[model samples]
Target: MDRIRRRRTGAVAGTLTALALAVTGLFAGGTGTAAADTRAVPQHAVTGYWQNFDNGAQVQKLGDVQDDYDIIAVAFADATGTPGQVTFNLDSAGLGGYTVDQFKADIKAKQAAGKSVIISVGGEKGAVAVDDAASASAFADSVYALMREYGFDGVDIDLENGLDSTYMTQALKSLAGKAGSGLVLTMAPQTIDMQSPSNEYFKTALAVKDILTVVNMQYYNSGSMLGCDGKVYSQGTVDFLTGLACIQLENGLAPSQVGIGVPASPQAAGGGYVFPDVVNNALDCLAKGTGCGSFKPSKTYPDIRGAMTWSTNWDAGAGSAWSKAVGPHVHDLP
Candidate 1:
């Protein structure tokens, strides 16, 4: 992926929407002109991933927070972007046996507990629901209704592996219809510019930046192996930066829409792994002598929003240390 890629953290500070989104607030239906507003303002709601785990029992466990991150993405394989092999059952990971009532209740509980959990669909897992566009639309309709039924603040289309724009666009549109003007719709895709990412993920996102909140570009690793190492490596600083820059520059992705996240396993983790990208990035930063547990703005791209790690459980002092750097990147984003 692009070495010019990125990551960072912080509380939903005061300055976030204050600078960039102010015009939208004033011109956005002409609601207010003199009040400094703040309260669940989905304005640049920077995201970080929580890979897999339902009910917050996994890494997002109720009492396991080592530190605070801006956004928490809950893994729901059913909502995944896996190719065209998805079905109504989806991947069983997202819907599982949990009904809409049960799931939404969980979301409400998490938010009440001071944590923001967004539903993440599409991943290395198996959530693809069939290649047919109709099927995809149906799937999106169901998920969109579910988001409403469950009261989720937003949805994420993490086509980490499957699906395409045709279906993805339908799905996003479905979610947005039910969500209306207040809900969020995001997509996470690889930085390598593809023709169509996640059912027109790029085009649709640009077309509807108002609803499509974040376009998290996987920067650390993407495409194929560096050789036969069978392991993924972080793109050098220049490659990463340029790659991500290309994504935003051409895709019509807003500076706020573009996001950076950690891929688990400093090496390759396609199998079954649950850990934060902090350790991996930190280790690489250490080897590169850039020093781990730090966040820096891209000299060329300062409109960056937020950074995310694959997993969250602090493995060692390294993971905890990286958490400390989250605030600087998130709060100081341009």
Candidate 2:
């Protein structure tokens, strides 16, 4: 997909303001009432991205999403006329007459069923920028607005364009302040973005580790990269999954915050599409240190968060084989 060449470009901005906000305590304090209302996520949960726009995949309303997914991230919230701000527009006409009310209702029903429905900010084509304090604030405000309007649990950062760790950290902290501790913040960085702790995306994830939920690093579409072992590993294999995940686990992220993200079907991504058993094996290998391919972690991470897929719609097009097998397997991780 030429993802590497499409990196987001721009110089970092609003550094002084970001630091000022932090020093003046503008980032402190959240709504206590909202904390009590936060939805509790499972220790071992499966996350799936729900496509808001049809792309040759099965079209589904929010309610049509299966129960196997613990977290349903609405594929994308579009970049607005204002930089760093985003908004959602349900493709009612495209979704076969699904209305805004029905979409909102479906989100509520999913939450009522103990599932979290959040808005994902970016995708392969996402370009929303939060490189400064004003933009950062805009990002938080608009996303929170969407949260209120649609009953979303929180936000997901899938900004494939690029990210500024400094302002993004501030934006999320401001978001947590308004949304409370219950805010479910997740990130879906490309595999290369997470290969090092010093990367902007990795730094942002660590900067907000307290409120951050899981970092489901995309393990496909990437050719080969260095694992925690400092050796090169190719994608679409058990070693590729566990070996790369080791980099995050061994770094600043907690065992509970790491997840293995893969394509739900061959059509879901350009490359690195493995069968469901490979995903399960990688999970078992990481959690139990068994069922491993070539690479194994130095120690087992029984508390490892779980798995994530590109799109739930693709899984449905393939008879739900990805979720049918991977969903139960993720929940069963020990």
Candidate 3:
């Protein structure tokens, strides 16, 4: 189809996946994302970020939630710090208005089962742009307010473009304190230049790594800015992420504090699906069984603690699921 790339609205467009299928009565298509299901690699215990690239089945997903994982972050930034004047988009109602109690219950249940739940703030377009650190802090505080009100275990800082994290690092650590329960202070920093540091990302990262629980480098996005070497070379399926890991380590982030970013869709595509498109494609491939396919997480980044997806719903359906892909590599960590 020439990959014409239809420019969907931020919401619609951002939701698109490389596994690309228009859903002709529930069907699957693509190659690397092959079908029917995947032989699930071991899911990492370090995973906690979950994007809100879902529609409808969100409650069902949470309803069936188990705590085999370490962290569980939901997509969304606080609306008060929104772009322009929009308000209240990234909230509990993201999928199906999951109540605060329901969310708390999910967190508690998962915690009981040994998992952690975090509220992800500032997605690709949720709110917050990296124009300056000052703006980023405003956005971070807005998100912080929401976390406190809802009694969340923590918050994920994913300010993709609009505000330089340098301005928000202090705010992040500060907000991290308000996140509660020794709240995990995770941050998602973009890779800018290695020679020195664009927007002083490395120094900012090091400054906050101690207070930060995890710093997920959006690998693919990081590669574009940092260089394609991570994907084009290295030992893992996506060398960019491997390189990113190195960068984080060099910047003072511990392996346990750093995680490779794998979204459900391509950033070039529109910054949607925080999960692995490979897993999405693989599930659809499994559902349709060789009808069409794309990629799978197991076939992608085969190393590290594991991987994180945007949400639990994108893994929905009678077949082709994110959870299924967690089987083989579930015990990836020590």
Task: Show the lowest summed lDDT stretch of 10 residues, model 3.
Answer: 29-38
Question: In every candidate, how many clashes are there?
Answer: 32, 1, 50
lDDT of 3 by residue, 1-334 (tens): 0012101232122222311232111111111111111112123443534444343333343445433346666655445544422123434554467665765666566666656566766665555454455555565566666656654566676655444545666666666555533656556654432212234555566566556565565543321322112222211133344433444443334444555545433322233233443433322232223212222122123223445543343333323244555523445333
Q: Model 2: residues >4 Å from true position, as ranges?
A: 1-38
Question: Which parts of model 1 have CA positions greater than 4 angstroms off?
Answer: 1-45, 54-67, 79-106, 113-115, 130-133, 193-201, 223-239, 264-302, 314-319
lDDT of 1 by residue, 1-334 (tens): 1111112222132432332232121211111111111235333344555533442223333224443555566655353354332222322353244444454565676666655666666665534653567765666666665555555566666654444555566666666676566565556665433222223455556555656556665554443211111112234342343333333533345455555555434422222222334433332332232433223222233344455555443211244544555534455433
Better of 2 and 3 by TM-score: 2
Point to the candidate with the largest TM-score: 2
What lDDT score is found at residue 245 in candidate 1?
34
What are the models' TM-scores? Answer: 0.60, 0.89, 0.60
**Top candidate when judged by lDDT against the true structure:** 2
- Lowest lDDT 10-residue stretch of candidate 1: 28-37
